[model samples]
Target: MNANVENQSPLLRNALEFAKANWWMFLLGGILYILFGILALARPASALLALAVVFACFLLVDGIFSAVRALGAKGAEGRWWVFFAGLVSILIGLYALFGPVNTVLLFVYVVAFQAILFGVSIFMFGVSIRKAVSGEWMLYLTGVLSVLFGLLLLWAPGIGGLSVSLMVGAWALVIGILRVVFAFRVRSLVRNT
Candidate 1:
């Protein structure tokens, strides 16, 4: 192990050590994420509810942490802002927990708006780069597709919710597989070392 460490660059050695130590965490997280993705894909309605509950819990915890940090940071600049943000997060968390359906709808609306804004930005970028970059048309195409998808979501938010769930599921599954692969790779590194 010492010889192997000496042969590697300092950054690579540290990263390998970190990965060796944390490989189990990656494996566990990957399994959990894969299960979550499967469940979300199999039942999108349930996924939405689960997502809302999870988000609420996360917000509550984050708010509490932020509030504590703000209170602990006596005489620190912008501490009040942190407290204010925490309060808002707590309120929103409570609302989301109690009014899940409404929260989901709101999330869908936000996603729609975000997609539209993203599409417009992409389109603008494509236009800006038209003169300097070839294949700018691909960006324009992607922007158009994004805009159309957003418009469709606005037209039917129920479908949008399902789409969001599916997308989240697919993303989670892909990330889970990557993590699992990484865990095995790290384990191999440990063995090699």
Candidate 2:
């Protein structure tokens, strides 16, 4: 056995076990990602209001799952941070869902801030448990893309509805695909167990 596997922290070990049992969850999540990614890409120039609603739904889903994963984790290291990140996501989702957005640029800065925080938290968690399983690095890459997406939003908040849609669409595509890959790898790991 690999020394690293034997020496895994309790948190990492438990997380791996959880992942093994929940491989199908990841697969379902992967399908959702592909669907959502395609949605964002399909209508790159969709109206700001429509995009905002879609994004809000996406954030809500992300937040709920994140919180569920964090809270349900057996020994997740820094689990509180994950909860915090989920909370931030929820709040942002709520804002995006209901907050006034007469223009495309309205929530850009706010969303950017939330995205940066979410990205940092995700990256940190990924690093914390990277050695626990295969394909975990993809989580880190997701964080990197997330952070970059946020920075892009921040860098050009006034880019308009179409551009924002495109960026969001592209980000969703890559990150969702990464999740799909990570999920399948975990599935295979579980199958062999």
Candidate 3:
């Protein structure tokens, strides 16, 4: 094991150690996202208000996890970006939870902006960690998908509740799967190390 550790690059070793400590955050977040996605998809017609609430809860928990992960990963590349993203998520989550978002259009705009910001941050983080992580492309893909989804929503804010629900559901499902896979990959790095 010492020999194996010695053979790995320092950055990779640090990343793996970080993953060992923080992988559960990813797993938990992914599971919640999956559940939310399933719920949204299962009843699109009745998912509008529920989606807002679920989105708020998801962002809050995910933000907390991301913030914790960033804090724990000292010296890791793009930790600050993760932290910033986490902060943004928290703020948005709080607003959505407490603010009076009475209209579907408002909700759509809020989700759209949040998704775009998150996607950009995740993409930058992936780029920063590419040298240390083997499957960084998953992050890139997730980020791209998020940005595209956000753009789609922004372009069609009047697409009605049903369409929004389906799109949000599909996006959440894909992102959840990606996060779950990435979490497992990070866990594998710990074993390899």
Top-TM-score structure, candidate number = 3
**Candidate 1 RMSD to the correct structure:** 11.7
Q: Candidate 3: what lDDT? A: 0.83
- What TM-score would every model get versus the actual structure? 0.49, 0.87, 0.91
What does candidate 2's lDDT look like per residue over 96-187, in tens digits? 88877556786676667766877787687777667866556787888887898899898889887777777766776786787788778877
Give candidate 1's whole-model lDDT: 0.58
lDDT of 3 at 72: 86
How much lDDT does each candidate structure score? 0.58, 0.72, 0.83
Alpha carbon lDDT at 10, candidate 3: 69
Clashing pairs in 2: none
**In candidate 3, which residue pairs clash?**
none
Off by over 4 Å in 3: 1-13
User: How do the residues 23-73 of candidate 3 rate in per-residue lDDT, one tens digit apiece?
Assistant: 778788788878888998999998799889889988998888888888888
What is the per-residue lDDT of model 1 for residues 8-126, given as tens digits with 9 covering 90 to 100?
45544443454455556557656665776687789887678676566455446645654664565454334455466566657766766776446567766644553465356446544
